[model samples]
Target: MKKEKQYINIFIIFLFILVSLLMIIPLVRNGRINAYSDWTFHSARVQQIYLNLQRGNLLTFIATDVSQHTGVGTFLFYPYLFLYPWAIFKLVVSPVTAFYLWYASITLLTLIISYYSMMRFSKENYVQSLIFAFVYMLVPYRLYLGQVVLGEFIAATFLPLVFLGLYEILWGDLKKWYLLSIGMSLLVYSHILSVYLSCQVIALIFAGYLILSKISIKRIKVLLYSAILTIFLSLPVVVLFITDFIGKGIATTFTGIAIEPEFNSVIVDSFRNWNGFNIGLILMVTFIIGGVIVRKNKQLKYIYVLGVLLTIAATSVVPWYMFSNTILGKVQLTNRYFSFGDLFLAVIASYGLSRLFDKKLDIVRKSILMFLISIGSVFIFYASSTWVLQETHTYNKELYLLLQPKKKNGVPKIPDRVQLDNNNYNYQFEYRSLTGSSDYYPIKAYDNQSKVDSILNQETYINGKRRKLIGRYNTNTIKYRISLKSKSRVDLPVIKYNHTEVYVNNNLIKNSRISDRGTIDLTLDKGMNNINIKYQPNFSFYTCVIISAIIWLLLFIYIVKVW
Candidate 1:
């Protein structure tokens, strides 16, 4: 009987994973969707890395490059940086076939974590578990922003494990503390944003556990031991965190904190323009119902209830949104972090409905009908918001046309270089000969070396006639300059505190005052003139050491307790 039940559990997980894959199958066969800017950047980065690998260019693969949209240099080699790695199989396998494989892998991992969570929380059946997994996987924003927009599909896989670890540490078997620690550590490696949000959620759960778990020395030991073990296991991620934090110049990065956007616009950007993808109504309802149903199961109730309350508070009430934005100023406020609440809300609603039906209520048929309707509402919302990537036509049709020339030979005769001047500075070249192809020539021009802001005062001219430059590039190097214009300026350009010199004609332009803009007026020679600007972030010795020590101490305590 026991073995039979185990087999049934396995079958249930397999079925849930299968259902999840079916929902996202459309992504498998399509050309890229025109959605989030981040998606395009990540995809391009992944392709660049793969190309470098093919060409044996390890140094180039690791170098940071300025992101046209962000105006900041990005760490390209960050693990989970992009999704195109999975897409490469499109060369050999049909996209539809490839998507199924990718979807199955992502869902199966989610299912394992969800199953473990449910088992630890309640004696639920296969149908109940399946319902929870389905709802969790189908949240519209996650479907839209995470899976389709950011190609942060890997985040969905990591989060479930984080919760599973939390469950083990808080309510499950004591010996599993080490396992829980490892789960938390793994989450850190997946995506830093998700990890940060999870930490907030976990803190609430920990507080609840401390208050309600019949506090005893033994229980304290379990909690602390689990923490210690978790930290010890997180050593790898800790090293990564330190390396990335220092390497990226966190002090300079923090300057954006002062200019973060307000909450109103964040809501508009994230949900108001949902076009059916933002299912805020369905999320609210599901969470409320789930909260009521799970009240008896204190452990289960705490997470869902706290998650809902905190999500609402963060996005609306408490300054979590404002605070996080202010703290992370310069970063746009898109409430993807609240996505974690969506999964738990759906799980609670599904599990509650499943439990309500199990009671064999006198009005069984009516109750089941109501439950089905409620879940169906979510499905409807999901369908309405779900975006279908337009795959009927590819964007790089022009590139393919250009490459047609190469079909007759070994390589395409791509333009190796081009020249431009301020009078006729704009240049456009198609690497491929596709007409109206958008993908072959994706570029963004940066006026300065930083590449952090959009170009507001630049004019383009192609072949001695004015034309809009298709994209932007740096004006720093002679190779990059391609052309030169009038160098004389009436007012100096502002230099950010983090950057040092603004150079013209290989000469350093100094700031006249501490707050003086770093603009310079000069004239360029008719031919090629090299212009370069270099920025080096100044780090605070005291701040860095203090933060470093605090993080280590925390990790040490967590590991020792878990061990």
Candidate 2:
């Protein structure tokens, strides 16, 4: 028994090393992230977050940089929690190196979390756990999200924890409610759309669970507890999402527009393609075979069914277009369903393969099976990269400036001012409002986006006179010193939201008016008046942040105490 345990420990070490080292394939193959459909957008986001953090803006909401310095309110509508980690990395490293390190960190996290969740599901089957980690991480869809640097898939790292929390609540140990909260909260922090997608899938699972099993009061309470705790923990982001969206403070690219993409053939998606992603061949085959063979476990059966149903939803089998204008179409992309599909199917496949890939199996057979899986995973990664990384328009362009060749001296220092182009959406899956689309631009600002140069370059309006006066801008706050004779009305270039506040010499000016350009309008006192224009979210925002922080801290303590 001692000898066996030693071998297992060694193998686990090997697994960790293998996974960590393998993350270098992309970095080694391509030194920098290619500006694919969303690369410019995400890279810009990272840069903005880095700047904000550098300037000590802990709660960054309004960006004061993009779109010719008109800035964007993306932080209002999007959850920026996961990006914080990447942004922190940017503070210490070059963007190129920072991105690569962030990628590896996310992958390692996914592996560890997915493995633990699968171990719970498979009743501590190490082999099954390993397979679950690989299958979840290696799927074409998830990796494709990463290749483009889209954030929804980053939230996927916590999905296994979400699944485990559900499992523990409904079927296993009931004391681990914090796991669900942690998972859902992280999802909200990472991506709003993932939270939306997750909620729908969770509802379906509950519906199915309620149908098959007897309704129990205990079960409902556990589930509700997990949910309420998650809500409180994620309230900071949730409130922002609600406030911005409900207030109609801005126009988003897909705000009122509903689009249904034409489906790629299932066969093409299952194999390999330059087309967008779906569940690939290995997953498809595994799901079918595993679902049929692993019949004894009812839980596994439900997993199988959910996977199949979601796969259909992602493809043409479901009449997605019919509901184009409905709330369902609000999801925008049908393939997003496949993230959940991949999750459930990975579980089923891991289970089915577990018995065959057991340690008791012949050494040669086990070796061969592992070899095949290893090769197939590599193939999936390559196939996913075929389009985005390989053919990106800015593939040859570095994140900021090209690296100085080896032996060259006086490499460029970081720029004092970084300019981000609109790179606006043209409806071909290309966009860079720092999102997949130009989300949450004030309506007036978006209309004037074309004239951003003129807007910024034009003289500032002061007492009906043109003055070339601009404020000193950090990421969130812009300050200006304006000297005047007598009282005068001034129009600063700063854009104003309902939540935006104006203060003169540290005195709050309530009932501030907006200029014709949709920016803040100010009445100034004579002599030098200090003007501060910045976004200050309402009381509810701070309340949510405080509550969310408390909940998260409690959850963290519980984690240390319990697990």
lDDT (Cα atoms) of all candidates against the true structure: 0.45, 0.68
lDDT of 2 by residue, 379-430 (tens): 5555666644453324332333332233222112222222221221111111
Stretches off by above 4 angstroms in model 1 are 27-32, 52-77, 81-104, 147-153, 218-237, 247-282, 319-334, 359-382, 385-563
Candidate 2 error regions (>4 Å): 1-14, 25-29, 239-245, 252-264, 273-275, 287-290, 359-438, 443-470, 481-493, 505-507, 515-518, 523-530, 538-544
How many clashes in candidate 2?
Answer: 0
Please give, for residues 1-563, the per-residue lDDT of candidate 1 as tens digits: 57656665665654555455554555444433332234434434443344444444432212112222111223321444324434454334543344345545665666666665655555645556656665565555555554343434567665665676667656676565555555565565455556556676777777877777766566567767766655554444454345434443222222122222244543444344233234354455665466677778865676677657644543434444445545433333335555666666766766666665554433435334434543563454345444344322244342222222313222222232221111111112212111111111112222232211111122222222322222222221111243445432222122222333445556765652221112222344455545443333234323443564576577668768975
